[model samples]
Target: MKVVIIFNHPYEGSYCNAILKSTLLGLQIANHQVDVIHLDKENFNPVMRSEDLRAFINKNPIDEKVIEFGDRLKDAEHLIFIFPIWWELMPALMKGFIDKVIFPGVAYDYVNASNTKMKPLWDKVKGITVITTMNTPSILYNWIFGNAIQKALLRGTFWKLGYKNRKWISLNRVKMVSPEKRKKWLTNIESNFSKLK
Candidate 1:
């Protein structure tokens, strides 16, 4: 299977990187072909320009490497997102990736004036997994903010894009976790990554 990991972190020592490494190693050990799209290293701009918006609305397109990568996302059999949840939301760079790359006519299609068809891309991508870190506890965040970010990615985007099997691994209260626990979490991530199709 071809697995794509979308690594969305600026630094190398963060939990996001740990997750990426563990997951990639696991996939390789399981004999799966793995590829990575490192957001920060790719120098992807998260900002949406006024001109870009006009191009989008007019059916023209932006000429960024990230957008091209988004086109690549359609070819995966399994998709993974490795990032951090900051302030109960997705990181700014990941958010930008979604905003700038996952555009109309790519992830999905809504065409015609009267005749309408909702077509989903990534139909072959049967699995999606989110490996995320959060400083707040799940209980506290759920009570205060709920799972908006998870829902947006899983139920909203992945489901709409026709990904059937999805899993979300959120390491909550990451700032308070011990090193041993973090290591254990990474181990478990390796196990889970091996199970994805």
Candidate 2:
């Protein structure tokens, strides 16, 4: 399968980076072709400008970066997102990617004449895996925050786009954990992802 991994983290040595590396290793073990998008490293502009809004509203391509990312999404069969939860939500860059790349004409199209219903365009995509890390406990993140990231991505985005096999893996209390525990998490991520079809 062709897998596209979107990584959002400013620090190269951060735990999120380790998770991304482990995920790549696992995908390689599965013999899956992988394409990685490092948002920060690419200096991706998270802000949606006036021209971007115009293009989006007009159902035209937003920009070159968005077009490139959209093309990658179009070709991929699996999508993986790795990032750290900041302030109980995803970083602005990732959110911006969603806003910019998943445009009207690219990710979906209106189904009804009234435009009340819609259909997914990227029918090639089968599964989506979101890996997130946070300093809060898992229960608190889920119960208190209502798993905002998962809701936004899975329910609000992919589910609406006809993706069903969506999985969310949250590594909670990351800062409070020991190095050994972190290592174990990496191993677990690799083992689990290696089994992905």
Candidate 3:
């Protein structure tokens, strides 16, 4: 499988980084080809400029970065997103990636003669998995916050793009978890990813 892992975190030593490493290890053990996009390290611009919006509207190439990211996404069969849930949402960088890269011609196409319908272009993509960590309790985040990331990504984006097999793994109360528990979580992530085929 060709997997593209999008990682959004500023610190290299954070638990999110550990999760990324574990995920890579598991994918490697399964002999899957993997590519990683580290938004912070790449200094990805999260702000969408007016020119970008205009180009997108005109069906023109937005920029080189978006084109490159879109190419990676185009080639991948599986997509994995690793990030921390901040205030019930993903960071601005990840959101910007979605806005800029998953544009009209890339991820979906407007159905001709229909303003409300779109046909998904990423038909080669089999599945999408989102791994998120939060400082809040799982139940509270799910019930109170309505699992914002899951709903937004799975329902709003992936499903709208025509992908059906999606999984969301949320690690809650991350700040309160002990080192041992964190390690165990890493093991679980590795085990889960290793089974992907």
Candidate 4:
């Protein structure tokens, strides 16, 4: 299986980076072909300019990076997203990736004349996994923020795209957790992904 990880987070020593490393190790153990799209390292342009909008209207992408990412996604079987939840939402670059890369033609297309229904174009992608770290507790984030990531990223985007196997693994209150607890979480992540189907 080809597993593509869309990773974001600027800090190298951050817990998000650690989770990414653990995920890579697990995927390697499972002998999955892994690709990491490091948004911050690539310095991906999140802003959709005038040309981008025009290309979008025509179902075309002008940016070479977006084109390349779309090409890679064509063969992906499992998609993973790794990042830190800031302000109870994903980072701007991650949001931009969705805005640009997951375009109408690239990710989905209308299923009817009214354009009210959408069908996913990703024939090979079977599942999506989102791994996130945050300072807020999971319960509070859900209760206060209304689990925006779930509603927006998973349910709003991928579910609407026709992918059913969507999963979210959130490690909350990272700053309050001890180093040992964090290590345990990493171990669990590695173990679970190693056995991922």
lDDT per residue for candidate 3 within 82-149, as digits (tens), equals 99998999999999988887888877787876546777776677889999988999989989879888
lDDT of 1 by residue, 122-192 (tens): 66677788888888888887677878776798888767655678788889887798989989998988897
- Stretch of 10 with least lDDT, candidate 2: 112-121
The positional error of residue 17 in candidate 4, measured at the CA in angstroms, is 0.6
Which pairs, if any, clash in model 3? none
Residue pairs clashing, model 4: none
Give Cα-based local distance difference scores for all models: 0.78, 0.88, 0.87, 0.92
lDDT by residue (tens digit), candidate 2, 35-95: 9999998767878899988887677875788878877778888899999999999999999
How much does candidate 4 score in TM-score? 0.97
Runs in model 4 deviating more than 4 A are: none
**lDDT of each residue in 83-195, candidate 4, tens digit only:** 99999999999999999998878877889988888887777998899999999998899998899999999999988888999999999999999999999999999998999
lDDT winner among the candidates?
Answer: 4
TM-score to native of every candidate shown: 0.90, 0.95, 0.95, 0.97
The candidate 4 region of ten consecutive residues with least summed lDDT is: 104-113
In terms of lDDT, the poorest run of 10 residues in model 1 is: 110-119
| Candidate of highest TM-score | 4
